[model samples]
Target: MTQAIPTPQAAINAVAEATQQTPRKITIAMAQYSQLPIGRPFGCFANSVRHIAHETGAEGRTPQLIAFPEMHLFGTPGMTDDERHTMERSAATDLHDELSDNFAALAKELGVWLIPGTVCEKNPGGYVFNTMPVYAPDGTLAAAYRKICPWRPYEQYTPGTSLTTVDLPGFGRLGLTICYDAWFPEISRNLAWMGADLIINLVRTTTPDRAQELVLARANAIANQTFVLSLNAPEPEGYGSSLLVSPEGDVIAAMEGATPGLLIRTIDLGATRRTQEHGTLGLNRIWHQFHPEDLPVPLPLYGGRIDPQSWHPRHTAITAT
Candidate 1:
């Protein structure tokens, strides 16, 4: 059964209690990787992760979580979107079990949370969706977020419905988004409203539109007051510019060109809450800006209304996308 979160105070308490044991801080590895050839062994990925782990240990810190680019699980660099879709459709059934299991086992063996990028998942109804899965250190599947906004016309895949978030126990709630989904502000806003402190966007772009995506990263972070991290594939297949933005819209880290490199940073959890409590640079508290007793404001475009009452942070705990 889906668990509806409790009251506003109770929700905050739940998050606090879960994060009380350790400092709400963690090191994240944003791997800007290009795809290996179609027949490459999974050990290539394992070795890549191990290399990052070794470097992280050299810095006197272990990797707690690591995220790769959007198409990390399939296709070689330089493939067209049509080619990727073909590969995805062909391999959806054959590769799903093996790839997902490998990622889970990798997470368990490394004792790190892993987002190994989107898999081509076929639902029972025979529709395929671009799905990203999250794995806990214990090899359990923590969450799976489908790409609600698949790049359209040229690239076709069935879209997903639900917004997904995962609690990190000692850290904060992390929300998931895929490549083209960055264009939609509602997706990020809903995640922030659902109590997500950080948004992980997995991207793969080879076009000029990537410049606009960089702008959206900062815009979403500042507008929603949450930390935003985006990782993209490199060179031939992608524009390769990954970004990390702070709650105050500061560019904490970024990659400018099409190069296969990694971005590593230790992010502070609950920075969004702190920003909300103290205001952004002591200037704006967007989440608290609304009147508690205000009536719902209808929007004809969305076919819905905004309710002040539903603005509370008590988010549902269901994990699937």
Candidate 2:
């Protein structure tokens, strides 16, 4: 039988204290996903997670944590509401249900923490929300975070109101945020303020301006002085820039667009602490230098009124349903 993993609170305190002494090396696994069927997606995710864990171990490094991209098990991007709902239901995995249990079993078997990036959750409101579930090595549920922000035309989906952070046995406080949430600086900054040492962003973004958004993500890490693990979807809708950024804004590991593979990296918590204590590189300097009031105001381009029916080509011949 496998040993039981410690609870989240206990793990957090232990890892936080460990950071003051020796630098604990934690492995972050990023899995990229392509548009595929439900079974294929789950299989691909499972293989990638297991492979990365084994490969890192073979490299003489024990992987303490593995993370996958947003909606890795279930494919995203359906055209209509009915289609989307059907896909979501077909691909949805219950948190304490069978699918979650499968991942829990994987964590137990591998003895590694698993952050299954974001899964499509069936909410009570007859809508689906993107959620992230963290599992302990002993196959226990550690934490779950729902995406606070949903993308455009996704108003039909329920919005999440809470942010969550959990502790891993070998890793420090881990924060969870989904794709669209990364676009909101307040979310990450608040997590940092709440004592999160690492922020995991699971994304499936297909926008043309994603590269620019990555710059913002790096800024969040630099400004917060915390490690960031961002995993992106591989293809068909996502421009994969899956990456790991250090507290000082260094791109430690980055994968190019739509690449289906695992990107593994070791994070040193002590280094992050030292950088903060020195008051030269991390949050200390940012606190001393930047002020919110000093920021420039965003100018309004077009009027507040938006007539989608008049401007949108898709709505040109549409009638209200």
Candidate number with greatest lDDT: 1
lDDT for residue 182 in candidate 2, whole number 0-100: 82
Q: How high is each candidate's TM-score?
A: 0.87, 0.77
Candidate maximizing TM-score: 1
Supply the global lDDT for candidate 1.
Answer: 0.80
Candidate 2 per-residue lDDT over residues 54-130, each given as its tens digit: 77632467577887777766654555767866777767765878789888988998888887767778755666777
Clashes of each: 0, 0
Clashing residue pairs, backbone N/CA/C < 3 A, model 1:
none
Candidate 2: pairs in clash: none
Question: How much lDDT does candidate 2 score?
Answer: 0.70
Candidate 1: tens digits of C-alpha lDDT, residues 44-96: 98999878765663246767898898867677445676786777787774234
Q: Residue 261 deviation, candidate 2, in Å?
A: 2.6
Q: State, as a TM-score between 0 and 1, how close model 1 is to the true structure.
A: 0.87
